[model samples]
Target: MGVTGIGGLFFRADDPEALKAWYAQYLGVAPDGWTPWEQQAGPTIFEPFARSSDYFPAERQHMINFRVTGLDAMLERFRTAGIEVVTKAEWDSPEIGRFARIHDPEGNPIELWEPA
Candidate 1:
């Protein structure tokens, strides 16, 4: 049988409740007792990068890339919610698509990618 796509993304949170509420309020992702995100059907990129790859430039070591539909809308939402969203023109690629960066409460890099 062929392998399926990613089932879930689990990570550690200092305060799970607060983190969940933050995500729910901003990104529409509600962590209901560690439930997996109910994402829309679209391309789910699954690839491994070199350990020293500088593709995602961040002070932190690990970065989580999330697929989104409406980048502008999401960016605006984050801005209105008093969240900082960083976008770089150089990060945009004709092949990889548009990308924006944000940080979680614990300062984890989160890449918001809208595939072409």
Candidate 2:
């Protein structure tokens, strides 16, 4: 027996409260306080990025990808909320899925994925 699944993700934020609020407001994460969010299971990718990879910003140590249902709807929501959503044609395919990128208020890279 090995690891079951990801327990949680911990990171440092300049203003934890404000960051938490941003995540709650936009991503629908931690909407009901510090309780656990029940996620609908599917595919999860756990790949490490090369140091020289340009997939994400150079300054950030890591980028997180979250599975989503509706890519277009989410993109529209992000646009309506005044958040910049970055998408590229090369990042998507019929076999894998679609992806969009957005940064948190504190400049953390967040990737949204919608599986094909």
Candidate with maximal lDDT? 2
State the lDDT of candidate 1 residue by residue for 62-114, as single tens digits.
67788888999999988887789999898899998999998889787888999
C-alpha local distance difference test of each model: 0.80, 0.89
Off by over 4 Å in 1: 34-36, 57-61
- What TM-score does candidate 1 reach? 0.79
Model 2: per-residue Cα lDDT over 13-104, one tens digit each: 99999998999888888777569988887877788889899989989998989998888998999999899999999999999999899999
The most accurate candidate by TM-score is 2
| For model 2, the run of ten residues with the poorest summed lDDT | 30-39
* Cα lDDT over the full model 1: 0.80
TM-score of each: 0.79, 0.94
